[model samples]
Target: MTYTVNCSILLTELPLLERPAAAKAAGFDAVEFWWPFAEAVPADRDVDAFVNAVRDAGVQLSGLNFFAGDMPAGDRGLVSWVGRESEFKANIAVVAAIGERLGTRAFNALYGNRLEGSSPEAQAELAVENLSAAAQGIAEIGGTVLLEPVSGTPAYPLKTAADALAVIARAKDAGAENIKLLADFYHLAVNGDDVRAVIEDHAKDFGHIQIADNPGRGAPGTGALPLGEWITRSRELGYDGYIGLEYKAPQAEAFTWAIRPVAG
Candidate 1:
């Protein structure tokens, strides 16, 4: 029942190095983020400084994503993309090193969007290969590789918990045992999937869970989804992992609802 802030979305008003402190000030002892550097492999000094920021802020680095291209420019991931395999492979060691340094055990690897000319079978094969490699590298530090189902993009293949699990299965079959699903409720609800059913059937399959109300991707109370109930159900079903707050809120006051008791 612990909570972690996804610094990638929240606290954008502060500098990248300062977001961890901002999260701590907002009462979060742990934080997660997408790749903070523009480059896949940044300078050693940059990496050291980032690690220092989290340590100095007294917040634990709970999760981190491998570089997935320019996220703001509509690049979801490169691992499965045909020509980007080299880039994707090059990032594995860097991500593993960072995870070890930060004591982060959860790593998310986005399945890239489908390419225009590539066949689905080709992309699927590549995804399995790259994911297997990622899982192998992360496993060295006793970390798990997370596969997420993102919403609102048809080109992105994994749009449901089942979809992500299937990919995890493929990776495991390929000899990578550390793969697990990252059940992000906002994406599932936004994609029009039954969020509760996913929780009921696959709560035990999830390694991590993230939440943001649907429709607007805002704080829990700002949307009509039964977030409190869903969270309560997840706990009832024995999901003791962190529930990451990965929403966009205009101000800090939007999180007041997080302090409320869970509905029965």
Candidate 2:
């Protein structure tokens, strides 16, 4: 199976700008990332540095997330956030520019967590608008906007494949055909979704797939979540795309699962 390493989660030991080279040295031809900047519209020089890093390292930018507000501080995304529509719209240009520069086509847009005062219905409506805008912006680069079900955050509404797919359908109804689902196995399992059933029912609906084992969200073998079977099932059901390695662990042991043969 082919894979792309998620530099944002795996190579934590290296400086942000250096993870691409580290990923290349580790034998991956492609790497992906969350928004790799503090602000939505980062300074031009920072964008240049990120683009140049991937170029110099000779790896493809397989996928990227549009700015998800302050991830470390618990801001999941801006798409549904009541007041930050401008920031998300602003980041689209930046994301499109970077995707064009690095040949990336898949873009993950994390659905925002539910805010206290914001009505869920309103947030959901706003999400479609933001996601539609994102789809249009990335379309110039032949890009597809990805919606994913995130686990662990109680306020996060998209906790199952059905939930995200419904949103994608709504976005498509609004004329953003480039929008699709990002099937992250770890998150689905943790959220109590039957992943195999999801694959069986909606394989072609996936635009991308990210994998990390449960328990600690580590490499595949670190937990017994049947990730291999899910992966094999995903392929058998027709998910012919890069399986993103978005696991967490120290650099010394993060890829231990890859060293062993994958199970079918």
lDDT per residue for candidate 1 within 63-109, as digits (tens), equals 99999998898889877899888888888999999899989999999
- Candidate 2: regions farther than 4 A off: 260-264
Q: Please tell me which predicted candidate would have the highest lDDT against the true structure.
A: 2
lDDT of 2 by residue, 1-264 (tens): 788999999899999999998888877888999999999999999999999999998899999998999898888999899899998999999999999989999999989999999999999899999999999999998999999999988989999999999898899999999998899999999999999899998877789989998799989888879988887888888889999999899998877667533222
TM-score of each: 0.96, 0.97
Model 2: worst 10 consecutive residues (lDDT sum): 255-264
lDDT of each: 0.88, 0.91
What's the count of clashing pairs in each model shown?
A: 0, 0
Q: Residue 183 in model 2: shift from native, Å?
A: 0.5
